[model samples]
Target chain A: MKAVGEESASQELQRVVGAGRRADWVMASIGLAILIVAMGTLISVFADLIHSGWPRLTDPDFYTNFPSRRASDAGILSAWVGTSLVMLVTIVIVIPLGVAGGVYLEEYAPHNWISDFIEVNVSNLAGVPSIIYGLLALGLFVYTFGMGQTVLVAGLVLALLTLPVIIVATREAIRSIPQELREAAFALGADKWQTVRLYILPAARPGILTGAIVGLARAIGETAPVITIGALTFIAFLPPAPLQSDFPYLNFEWLNAPFTVMPIQMFNWVSRPQAEFQVNAAAAGVVLMIMTLAMNGLAIYVRFRLRGRVQ
Target chain B: MTSVDAVTEDPLLVRGRIQPSAEFLTHRRLADRLARVLLAAAAAVSVLVTTGIVYVLISESAGFFAHVPLKEFLTDTEWTPVFENARYGMLPLLAGTVTIAGIALLIAVPAGLALAVYLSEYAHVTVRETIKPLLELIEGVPTVVYGYFALLFVTPLLQRIIPGLPGFNMLSPGVVMGIAILPYTASLSEDAMRAVPKALREGGYALGFSRFRVATRVVIPAALSGISAAFVLGMSRAVGETMVVAIAAGQNANFTFNPLEGAATITAYIVQISMGDLPYGSIAYQSVFAVGLVLFIMTFLFNVAGFYLRRRFREVY
Candidate 1:
């Protein structure tokens, strides 16, 4: 677009040489510094947390006992237990619905407004502030459904919160499969359902697993909706084991049991005035951080592996 | 059809036939139809969630306006919804939210852009691969944990360096919020910058521009709309950030521009109110919905703008 003659090129070379070289180099150095400092904060945050929490974390009682007025006596047994239970329920609820929704949108839904509506709304739901989900749960689950503030209700809310992500991710995974596989299946007299089940899904399994794991990771860390569901800050008792004395042994009374999760426990500690509780909060945070980052790392690894295989 | 049927009758050609037994085919068809209906119903759940959110927010907030005048809620300087002489002014909370977001953007934008530039242009594939997932490790860390980090570690650090920094100030949370959002901004903007054709870089190099100059002036300008969208989206994340501000940025609702002061956000206010057992449909209870309504409208607008900008720029490429 600019003057491109040989004379102009020489002139431009001189112009760039005089001032632009130093400025650009300075900008690049700044860019490097920015990355360093950005990552440095993460390191320092974790370092400080580990430093403060390390001594207390080694104590067995930290995970064996429950919340206590004395921070030294407080632990996270119920919190961790409840978190796993909630995550389990959420996974059970979300995977089927999310995968089905993804399958439908990718394979079955036609070029129409219902498809468009579902697609657009799902993406938008991905952007909604999770606290709004808390409000929705407060109104819908805790009151409207009369589920009370229980493990099942909390799990359902978190499931709702992550449904969009799973759906969107699953759709992306499904979309990555080649069209020819479906066509070949169809040519062999496979119906839409059979083609999807026999050909596309198996090929898409790695991608779908990647999405589901990532989505579950998010559900595990979510706090706002769980808080809104009124998980107790001082949960001294564990929910009943998901079984009974009878031969069938399956019991859902635990579903209605009050619960607390790691994040909530950490929140309670951080909010306290006591200095010891701050350390306690730090310890819990370090544990929670490890859990979340490990989940994320595994998800990323799975995704990377999938991409390698796909190509 | 006749040819296919004739082929199916031949023992040697049976395996190649498209159709199986008629009875089995009908049964499979029925199952397929039923399964399609169920899968389609699953797809409809996302729409149901959207409707449920809209219905709850609207229906609850509808009764809030009957008591608090809309003009006062918007314009009044104070927000003391729980105090005896209560003022339901949204400005104080809005100011806190905007101020934190503003401070957060000041930190995140330049850092994010720089990180994007470094990642997109400077780093090799292996280096980028390793570093990127680590950054996302930051992204995936729970906000509550970040809140704790800001409150205990950062606030103390700030106090040591900057004399008289408040115990519960906005600066730490805002800064942490920036750090929290770095991955989103960096990743999105890098995607944009990378999408700028390599020809642009070559053009700059052909014109005697250095790598840095080519990256900054050439690729960045080309991706400006997408970069701006990332910044806007990051700002939206800051505004909606809950536990960090609630934990680190003090819960006192104040009308102030100073970053050193304590203040509450719309989210914090909701959290604070929820700490109590407010009876359903009470005026105070209704106020949470009203605050959420404002928050929803604010974020919704920003998200729409970001989405539109990303789309518009995407089309150009």
Candidate 2:
């Protein structure tokens, strides 16, 4: 009886020890799998982009000329210019509105039902898919406002789509400002508006800027919304200046200026049956990725610098 | 001192500080009231945007329902939106969306959960931090990149092993979508696992329960609500994903379950219709909105459910 009891106890110990080893192995294996897959993906994207972009990088006119019908003659200069112009306009529209609204909600507005409703809706808006914004641009910007499918209308639509994200980030940043700072500003006889402008805005500038850049990156990649708003497929000319140009001014005859963006261009290229187009798509993908990465890196750097200074 | 006197004499300041006349007080109250009004107007933008989206979808879809019976739209098998004699059966598009989403979940959940468990319970701090950012890089990669990668890399690789795999099939896109969303699930699940109190793990350890057993049986179940939320959010992402399905999954609007064959999701069909030169006020054009409405409804339901789950079962500890 004593021997049997000892034997069972030792067996239980063995089982427990084995289970522990198995668990550690399983965890290690899983961690390895995730790291491997992520690394593999990053390397592959970089590799493919470089391989495809090498040829395009050699062409002297690649950065200066417009896309042409011939495969050997096509370039991305106009698309690049259009992308920059629209993105700049979108940032100009979204930053002030998003920041001011965030400040109002975080600093001035009372914690009441009205504010709560706005808050919930804002969060929900953040989750609304991008394509729906395109639909809104179609109905309101294009149809009701009659913007005539210009870059202005497209930029406005993207600004709306990115507003919620900017607002959410700005609100969080503003909320993180120390209450003591606000109290000090008020004690100095500054009114609410003065306090926000002088103390709060300067203090929260880093977070606000980071959020704006992130929002800009998101807007830049958006194709579906712009497509819905009737962004043209093949514009030969540069976008007209927003104020100086009359309604459909660059030839109202060409009011339906076929426009294309980096993402849209890449999408079109990728879907074509020819292998050359796929390679072109990969090259465009590289450009888009570089642009996105640059934006994200700048935002990250700014955030770190701001945090350091504050500390 | 002179500057201070000049500032005090400014009209806005004079209006702010004077507390004498009844008329002045009334005007001051009006100014305060106007500030509140301005704030309300600012807050109205988001609400108006949402309302506009819904109204547009509804108005366009109303025209669609008028022309095609709701029953036929819901039950029809063919989806030839381009042909003059097009059938507007939405079932096939919906089925394709669900199948792709389901397969993506199948791929993402296990890997994500396992990764979460490892990061939460096993990995060293250095490894955890390094791996976490790397995983998030997957999120940072634009969906368009994923779409091309799927078409260029994953499809070719799969064809090597899976005989009869179409160049554009559900498998590659679904798998790529799963990978794209893997970070979301893993990061969230890791948070949930970490939220399981140390005391629970200690108790299991005292009782001779192995670490793996404790993690699988105690920590995961304890964090099930959050884990489930992660899964739901992943599904929502999969359903909403457009570029991958548009590029990789062939635009054949057939109702089938095979991952190896070509398929068309609702978003893919929407992309196709939007890309072409379909005339305004045409049924083909209306169908895009109709499809958009369905997509909207599906994602909205998921979002609401996810919000509720996160609220109800969120662990304060």
Candidate 3:
């Protein structure tokens, strides 16, 4: 009777194991299907954009001409130029501010309420909708500071939107450095500034770059805040040239010039009732998508290299 | 000889005083102090941003409230601020926002959790590495493109399945938004699950548990706090999303929970009012700020809650 009970127990264990293996297989299959669906959506979105936008995408003039009444005549010259200038201004503002903010939080901040308040503030700002930032710019920059709806205002808004990203990235990168490196520098009679400038910043370069690029990539595609700031949807004129042919070769007039960006251009086209305009929207999208994806791809590559080195 | 020894042993003797000039030391110290102040100022900018957002929203909304009573703003169902006979009710927009966000969360939470589990527990390192970046690429796609896709692609497909479905409906945008936020939720959840110690999984295995059981029963429970954080953050993102809902969902402010219907969210309303030719400081213009205040409060609460969850249940292994 005792031997019979042992045999039944063994049979039960085998049955359970068999069922568990089948369950694992089922879960794996479901997970694979989910991943494939996600990737398939991405590819299809790209293919659809390319297919619809092929005419404008292939045309050389499509990149050069200003917006026109005729769909075929319309190009993204003013839009692209405006986007580049705004991005240039954004880069100038965001890099130093984001990197410094990140360094202070990670290295200099004492364990106190002030640092905690800043930490909470940064995360909260990250969650605020892009449109709210536009409202802020409308009230603060346009009205109070009298920056108007210019390239500088757009840069300022995007810089603020992207700041938290860089700060978080910098902190994470800094955190990953071994504590022993800082200790060793201290032991060698090096001050905090020397250690940070020489050792910490160099080691964290890849991660910080990745963050900055990612932030810029996000900013480039943003639409709502720019719209809120009242960016003109139809801009036939470009901002004044930053470089001039006369004395005082640099011109500051463009900073105050009104501008439009790629995504806003796309928004204007997509909203048009005409089918031809929709085609133009698709083409514009293809251009915008390429830029953001390339930036993101570069960031990922940098991060991968950083991970490899650390490991 | 004794006098010379006494001079050499003086604590304040000129030991290396010539090697490093006092002036140079002061300069270096000044530079260091300057760097710290600049860095702190940079950090302070974030606080200022939050302050600016609050100040703008409240100040403008106060202008709105002085004209439209708070009760009417809350209880009234119609939202026709742009009309000649303007109505200040915000419930319809709020309902639409909640409906779309609810739909989005329903789809994103499950799929995201499953993706996280697969990445953290089942996939090989090479597979995970390749797939993770590709998944993140979904996020890199702009909301405007997703909006385009919702209007042009997904809506058409859905219309064929359900005849008489409106061209602009909440269902299509909500679905696309789910896909858009999936990477964010999945990546965060994966990090949380990965943080669960290996020893726990080993213990489950030693108890005759299979990998599936070990992951679901052991790892997931251990990482529950982190997974909740991901869920809340994703929810916050879904609520704040603007362009997709604005383009795909109709511009009409519909007050209903049915995903099949078209509606405008608070964000879509802001886009609508601001895009139109509203005079500065007009009632309609100030209404955007009022609506923005609502959006801000919703997202703020969710973010603070997520932050609290992350800190409160942070498992120190």
Compared with the true structure, all predictions reach lDDT values of 0.84, 0.78, 0.89
Mind giving the per-residue lDDT tens digits that candidate 3 earns over B1-317?
Answer: 12224323435344655444566557657878988899999999999999999999999889999999999999999999988899999999999999999988888899999989889989999999999889878998989999999999999999999999998899999999998999989998898888888999999999999889998999999988888988998988999999999999989988888899999999999998878888998999999999999999999998888877676556466
Q: In model 2, how large is the Cα lDDT of residue B220? A: 88
Q: Against the true structure, candidate 2 has what lDDT? A: 0.78
User: How accurately is candidate 2 docked according to DockQ?
Assistant: 0.42
Candidate 3 error regions (>4 Å): A1-7, A308-311, B1-19, B313-315
Which of the two candidates, 1 or 2, achieves a greater TM-score against the reference?
1
User: Best by lDDT, which number?
Assistant: 3
Docking class of 2: acceptable
**Error of model 2, residue A156, in angstroms:** 1.8
lDDT of 1 by residue, B1-317 (tens): 12324324534333655656676667778979998999999999988887888888888888988888999999999888778998889999999999998888898888899889988887878988888888887888888989999999889999999899988999999999988898889998998998899898999989977778888789999999999999888877888889999899888899997999989998888877776777877888889888988887787777777877787677897
Interface RMSD per candidate: 4.3, 3.7, 6.2
Candidate 2 structure quality by residue, lDDT tens digits, B1-317? 12224324535544455343566446545765665566556667878888888998998888888888889899998899788788989988988899898888897888899889888988888888667756755777778788999988899999999988889899999988887888888898898888888998998888877778888888988888888878887787788788888899988898888888888998888888878888777888888889888888887777666666665455456
Candidate that would win on DockQ:
3
Better of 2 and 3 by lDDT: 3
User: TM-scores for all candidates?
Assistant: 0.93, 0.88, 0.95
The DockQ figures for the candidates are 0.48, 0.42, 0.52
Model 3 chain B: weakest 10-residue lDDT segment is B1-10
